[model samples]
Target: MRIAILAHEQFPDGAKTALGVLRYADDEVVAVLDRDRSGHRVTDFVSDVQDAPIVAGMGDLEDDVDALLIGIAPIGGGFEESWREDVRTALERGCDVVSGLHYFLSEDEEFVELAAENGCELRDVRRPPDDLSVSEGVAADVDAEVILTVGTDCSVGKMTATMKLARDARAAGYDAEVIPTGQTGIMIEGWGIPVDRVVSDFTAGAVEEMILECGDDHDYLFVEGQGSIVHPAYSGVTCGILHGAMPDRLVLCHDAGRQAIGGYESFSLPSIPTYVDLYERLAEPVRDAPVVAGALNTAGLAEPAAREAVDEFAASLDAPATDVIRFGTDEVLETLLSSNPNR
Candidate 1:
């Protein structure tokens, strides 16, 4: 099957390239088209057959070609006419198009119409699930726990959420401390919890070490994946941890930019958005545990536009609090952790 993979945005570039590399390695790459600035392939742009007659874009697919993988990144940035033309061209040529790009992946009216008109079957592969098991002897209780935040695109809030939740618990007069558990060290000033760089064979070992440390000081531990496991920003280590930890409560945090058109689907697997969605998509393969709460954040001081989007999401999903932690404030976080809602 001749497959034409397209990359028009940032997040998908990494994933697209990675996919191409894998396919080529496995001798399945018919051709690769990447518009983003990626340093993976030595050639600026190359075709599969070297110098044979090839189709230009999606408009010219060979008779034997069966599938076309259209990848688009950076959806919130709005769509350009050229991109619309590309989509039109791809569909007009009669190819099976699969995309996990956020913008074109949603069930939006326009995209739905486009898919129908083009006779194209759109399958979104944004969130691929994690296939790892939880570490043994880690599921004891949930109190004064340690939170692990590590990976490619580790959010400051992932660790900060620990602070906010822990603080809220403390205000309710519970014992909790926010600890930084990961292989890498972050610049968390006020989160006065201990820092332990767990050495492991891989990322999974690091997570196990963090949880083991948590067992000593805190009963319950919350570990945040650095990036999207499904998206391109995710790390193999993070997925390993998720599989190995089998955490009691899986709190999936969604960035406000998520609902945007090309949000999560734009990137490759392991991206932050894709990682979170992976948990949502693959139910049994990933984890059987129920998600305690789906946290939402604007990734900053909540601008008016961002605030509006997040508010609507929080209202819809019933998230208790949204981005409630200030940066580098141990006292504030301590207070929040002290108030345990589960208690």
Candidate 2:
């Protein structure tokens, strides 16, 4: 089968590589589209697909291919329209379409109806991998009453939230350990949680091992996945880690500030977005999965703002107090977790 992947040039290397895996398994690739010209070339990875051919425009692929993998590279306003037209054209050509990039705007009723009428299968490729068939609880959840996963990167709140939950568990008189996913030090003692250094390697097996080690003997484990794997500068291998560990509950750390209000701007939230507005956005791909609310490092050294935000966000979502905590100071962490029984 001849498959064509239409993408923007700025697409993240990890996703491109993952798509390449699909390409490697499938037949020839007809085209690879992108708006930008320079970066780590996709051809290196998709050698066989490249051997077939690549065209600069999605329109160029028309009627020449059987399947069209629409790689939705995050594009802004005008480009988004152009890309949608390209997608529609591919569908009209009777091609099967799959996409992980965010392109479905609520207002795109015309495009949506057209796509439905055309019988194109638009699938989100970046959605969680569902075929693992791995057993949950096989590697015991950490036996410590609670475990905290921390980091020094953009989404430290994810780590802090996990730690606070652990501290809260201990303040309520349960044993807990707050370990840094990186080298960040534990600010306070007591609370009964120990901080450990995260492993440097971020491959699938390595991440799985880290989770197994951290969660060993602990009842509740807080694994932090900070930053978007799709972003270039903020490269932390978060997606691979998430895929490898598959934490009991994923607390996706997001920015809750002005930018992320409605999430109409971007399909996948930015790595360090201000806040999470669309709950359905986070829930859908993970199979309508449960997610703990996580925020970025906004309330550092401040008493009320971070705590208030987390509380309000949780209240709105009715998220479990036990599962959600402010990614802030030790005092705040203690206060948040102390109220929950599931620590």
What lDDT score belongs to each candidate, Candidate 1 first? 0.43, 0.43
Model 1 has an lDDT value of 0.43
The reply for model 2, stretches above 4 Å from the true place, is 1-153, 185-202, 255-289, 295-312, 315-343
lDDT of 1 at 25: 23
TM-score of each: 0.42, 0.37
Top model number, lDDT: 2
Q: Count the backbone clashes (under 3 Å) in each candidate.
A: 57, 21
Q: Candidate 1 at residue 227, lDDT?
A: 49
lDDT at 109 for candidate 2?
A: 69
lDDT score of model 2? 0.43
Q: On residues 271-342, what C-alpha lDDT tens digit does candidate 2 reach at each position?
A: 322322232343234323234434444433255776665565456545433223334334334433343443
Worst window of 10 by summed lDDT in candidate 2 = 188-197
Per-residue C-alpha lDDT of model 1 across residues 127-195, encoded as one tens digit per residue: 222332335534324233433332223342454455446556555665554434321111121111111
